[model samples]
Target: MSAGLLILFYLGLSLGPLILAWAQELDPRTPWDELATGLGFLALAIILVEFLLLGRFRLVTGRVGSDVVMRSHQLLARAALVLAVLHPFFYISPRTPAPAWDVTRQSVVDQSWHALWPGIVAWLLLGGLVAMALAKEVSGLRYQHWRLLHGLGAAVIAGFGVLHALRAGRYSADPALAAVWLALLALALGALAYVYLIAPLLRLRRPWRVREVRHEADRTWVLTLTPDFRGRLPYRAGQFAWLNVGKPVVSLDENPFSIASAPSAGPEIEFLIKEQGDSTCRTGQIAPGTRAWLEAPHGHLIIDKHPDAAGIALVAGGVGLAPLMGILRELHATGDQRPTALIYGNRHAGQIAYGPELERLAREHGTELVHVLSEPPPGWTGETGLITPDLLRRHFGPPDRHGWLYVLCGPPPMLTMVEDTLIDMGIPAHRILSEQFVYD
Candidate 1:
């Protein structure tokens, strides 16, 4: 089905009960039921479209135009929250006789209040979630901390929503509809359980024991791994795996780093991690014998799948050289002699990751290497001051904007500028590939 049809179908499922109520087929006696059922279905639709159709969880190969999916998910979630609130308040406000709350009221002294509490809690949590999502900035709140709270808050909201629905009976008058809602809820919960519990547990079971952790120059550590399980993890170079450093709390945290080593180099996988964050800061302290969890190679930048082109341009900034190293290694291993040029960008010569190695590889494979230093030493002989359009043209002979494939990996600002330059130079969006190493 077309996207338009899918959207219409989703909307119909969400508003079906309300439409029925408008037609007087849905009993007005169960106003509580009407509100709950409508909200529940709306929430389910949001969950289905995001997790199932949009592939939000499958961070590997999922490509649902980031802007479109993010905006839609946020909008749907906010609408669902509004419906969640209206469901209970509408049902309880003396508007409907033989109310769902009245039934609970007749049962016990404060049963009505108890039934009402879940909805209230859900609303409170949902309100916070929506605010956090929409807010431009939260004063003094760190992004990671806010993200963790957001996740926990979402869980609480979902739980309360489920509880509210179960307690309010009239809205889900049709047993089949109620069952469908419950099934969708269960599926969403299952997706969560699989991601946090089952998948991680499975990864834990099949650990990649630390075979080597060599501290390289420029505060970067080269980690080597040998799968404890018999065979090697079927992975492509330039892809990354989640590394579980072994402290009780740390073990639960998995950080993704590029597979710096070649795929042809056997089961012993390697990653070059630069110490730049809270996680990486302590990674160097990890002992030799600590067991590490590995989530296999995940990225769509594999050279073979991209495009068949004559010449390729690989751009790197600081530690962004890791993936390019993998790409070049793969090209060399296969004897694929496509004239390649690597524009290595860094603050200074000392900050460049894989500098010597890249130079050696270039000499061996006849690939061109151009080092661009942003903050060069007074006597520095390398090309200086950023990966500008002029530098790119000078070293690689004016970018073949329409034809040549440009693979970029760098800090967000640099990447943005580079992308803008490419677009201005008449390169189609599809022809240029980029992967942002956003930790979150």
Candidate 2:
């Protein structure tokens, strides 16, 4: 459906101008001014429809419609470029006694190939905009910089396209085309305003207040936030949320953090934070009652929907144990005894963030806990070295079971290695769920 709609939009965008131009030449008393008015209406409708479908506010489940809208806009933009290039050629009259291309005696408009330079630039920028969208996820670029570039590109394309059309005075030959151009310019500006100004401002209105801050071993801090809203944050146990500190206008940078606490029956939320990089290093100073913002509840690693599974395998490394804590706590709370097995890895036993709590939960819930350490002192027991395939096989049985789920979370390389090992050990791809904290 999305592909077909995009094709229809492309066809309409390509033929709109040509059909309007031809309708005028067909009737001597055709009131070309009326045709121009209609052209304006058509352009207005086209741009308005694009915004209505592709605008930022709409949320389709799992970003399904959003992806479709993006692809549709890209196709239309490309078609617009082709039409823009051909528009001048089609309108130039062969018998108008206009001179052949000349360099010196030409007016400024004719000197620049009928002002095609501006349209050419506009087309290039529009193409760049589409390419940028395609590379957004792959490039791992900063969001603020990407947003600014996207906005600037949109402004340049819309602004230059309008200037190109009006400067030629060809659109003035049809009032509708002129009106269409006006509406298109306004639509483009409106989109930018909504994205840059309104959305960010709204995210500021209701913020989370830090309720408590507890420092665990190894410089890990657990931040509990009480959302201003009265209900619990609608997030799954393994999902993460974007947290904002500082005001909307100035400190607009927010980092995504995994929620450490279970989906509690309360209004408070919690995040298990590791002080690794720049934004997180300052987490020590995040005092109680400090205001923060949240945008959230993403990821597909939760165990909520898989109630009938025979068992679950939870693999965690370092602070990646946070979400696993939520899962275990929820299972304990709900009195679930589904033979859950946890394989936690750390450099040393001292670096485990939720060591004590996990031990207690394991004892109470009858869930087996296996610890893997990279470096252990003399006489140290339990499994050692990385969570390699040999260790997994020695601990758990063969991975070809039908009713088991595997959840893994950690740094990228470690997770990749473990995931590959599991696949090689015969685990089904769909049975394994993974999460990565680092964002592009």
Q: Which candidate is the best by lDDT?
A: 1
Every model's TM-score: 0.77, 0.65
- Top TM-score prediction, candidate number: 1
lDDT of 2 by residue, 168-285 (tens): 4443346876665676577668866765566667766557888988887577888889887656678877767767865463343766677777786456777889887567888888
Candidate 1 Cα errors over 4 Å, as ranges: 1-44, 47-116, 130-150, 165-171, 247-251, 393-401
Error of 2 at 197 (Å): 3.8
The alpha-carbon root-mean-square deviation between model 1 and the true structure, to one decimal in Å, is: 5.6
TM-score quality measure for candidate 1: 0.77
- Candidate 1 lDDT at 352 equals 74
lDDT for 416 in candidate 1 is 82
